[model samples]
Target: MSIEVGSKVQGKVTGITNFGAFVELPEGSTGLVHISEVADNYVKDINEHLKVGDQVEVKVINVEKDGKIGLSIKKAKETQQPQRPRHNGPRNNRNDQRNQNKTESFEQKMNRFLKDSEDRLSSLKRNTESKRGGRGARRG
Candidate 1:
């Protein structure tokens, strides 16, 4: 069958290589299943996942100018759009964890405090030392 982008189709695995697999669809049209499109899980070896003559469902992700289709097995099985898990009832541990994480780490706070204190102390020492008439050169 002619495949279009975003359309899911059934195919038989015709060949497998290090890079991807070739699948022949109903109308004898062939498409490349890139290694990345083989599954939802990582596919380290394509042979382990598919063999010649195996039936598989794949989604057509692209159709090249030459009419060759780029297929994705992972996409064909994707029926539901992922939904953010719902939070029911009142917020609790999450907020507490957020509050705890909101504060600067102890080391950061201490470093900031030490830097400010050093600047203030240095300014104070300079002021006191300047009052001792140390600005200009003394009489030779």
Candidate 2:
């Protein structure tokens, strides 16, 4: 069977590498499931998720003119589930802070940054000096 973009197909994992896993689709065609595409979360190691001869359902994300195919196991799984609501997590809070910063004048932002930097530097110096028995302590 010919592989087409956006098609979900069943394939056997033929090989695994640091970057991705190669799957043998029907008719002996091979495609790569990139490490990032293997899962919704971070995939540090492909071996932990797949092994040779494992059967997997993959979505064909792209097909290059040179016969290379890009597949995603996560996309295939996503199709079966309803869309998830985004969490108002730390990332969103940081984005809100960034939006607030955008409204501030350049000079104001620079002054705030400088003040914060000076505070941090002074605190670091105090900690280091205390650890070394204060600046005037004689070394023995």
Q: Each prediction's Cα lDDT score?
A: 0.84, 0.91
lDDT (Cα, 0-100) at 125 in candidate 2: 92
Question: What are the candidates' C-alpha RMSDs?
Answer: 15.5, 5.4
- lDDT (tens digit, per residue) of candidate 2 on 27-46: 88999999999987789988
Error of 2 at 117 (Å): 12
Off by over 4 Å in 2: 86-89, 95-140
Per-residue lDDT over 19-107 for candidate 1, one digit per residue giving the tens place of the 0 to 100 score: 99999987889999999998776789999999999999888999999888899987887764564444553465555545676687888
| Position 94, candidate 2: lDDT | 57
